[model samples]
Target: MNERIEDKVHFTQYISVPSPTSSGRSAAWLAKNWHLLNHLVELEATTLSVSARIEESIRGRMLNVVVHLCNVEDDTDFTELVLLSLSSELVKIQSISADYIEREVRCNLRGRRVTSDENDEILKEIMDALEKRGVRIDYS
Candidate 1:
């Protein structure tokens, strides 16, 4: 069967890292650190500015780090390096995962759509880093 493949476009992904109760750090505190943000920029992982927003839910204050990847191709590498850099800061990382929207678009009979999968290598590295620090990773 002959089929045409559609090019996949990379969208913005959101990664949430919950604050640790023991660390006594608030979302604002972490956001102001700027160490991780600066490091990522230096490595050229992302040209997009990194912003940390604090959300107040029933669970309390949550730190959500938004990483804007300049190139979708660098998603995996960017994520891996960010997590690693954050680890060295002794920041308590609760979970690391991407938030993206999935939509279905109509295609011609000869066209097929392909989407990018989560960066497994980076995910694994983040998992290991979290585990070593006794932090929990959000796989869900």
Candidate 2:
């Protein structure tokens, strides 16, 4: 038998609190704010632009994005990561276990061109949504 090696990238996960994680509530928030899509944002150097959208999927939906890394220089990027629906069993898991929790709803983690902003706008949006529901989250 051969041991399988997983291909991974350098990234972080969302860790929330209050005893058992309320992944269901968190996922609901994501679906509610999903309409914040179809946007064009430029990179720091003004040399790139990112186009993000939400596309329908069988498993739920995915964050579809594309980046013209060059603006004229190179081209690049969106990301996926399922956002398990509220009705799904995975959504009931705790938030701290990044791997165990149902990621049916998650922000784009793949940092392709790397935004120029000091803080990620998408993450901020998510945080705001959770705040409304009285859910506190920390990314680690």
Candidate 3:
């Protein structure tokens, strides 16, 4: 009997969070004048742009997002925005963890551990969407 050696490679994916052209502008406006628009700003507006990475494995990918927020009193609004944006990514979420780092908040959203077969199909779709949205991604 012969054992097959695992062909392993570490894929480090990088995504940049720029102020979204159309949506960013709207969000910014709301953030600045949230006090005026009583019903406009749903959340407290703690965050704006988010930077994340996808570490791919034989099973599934892990997503780590660094959430950035404007200096405000609370983060309820910002967190909602972050989650909404991420939900559009179509990454099967497994777990979510968050913490504060000085002025920025780091929210690590890990994807459901999947097998290589599932990954091969969903990986490109998610990557393409991110790329199309101007979220620069680099895999190595």
- Residue 121, model 1: lDDT of 32
Each model's C-alpha lDDT? 0.34, 0.34, 0.35
TM-scores vs. true structure, each candidate = 0.22, 0.25, 0.21
Cα misplacement distance, residue 131 of candidate 3 (Å): 0.6
Query: Candidate 1, which segments miss by more than 4 Å at Cα?
Result: 1-80, 83-118
> Model 2: per-residue lDDT, tens digit, 1-140?
22222222322233232233667875775566444321212212333333323233456432222211234344433233322222222222433232322142233334544453412443344344333433333456
Candidate 2 positional error at 105, Å: 12
Task: Estimate, for each residue in 37-132, the C-alpha lDDT of model 3 and write its tens digit.
Answer: 443222222223323333333343433332332224443534311222333243443222212211122122234222344334334444444455
Reference-based TM-score, model 1: 0.22
Candidate 2 lDDT score at position 93? 41
Worst 10 residues of 2 by lDDT: 36-45
Best by TM-score: 2
Best prediction by lDDT? 3
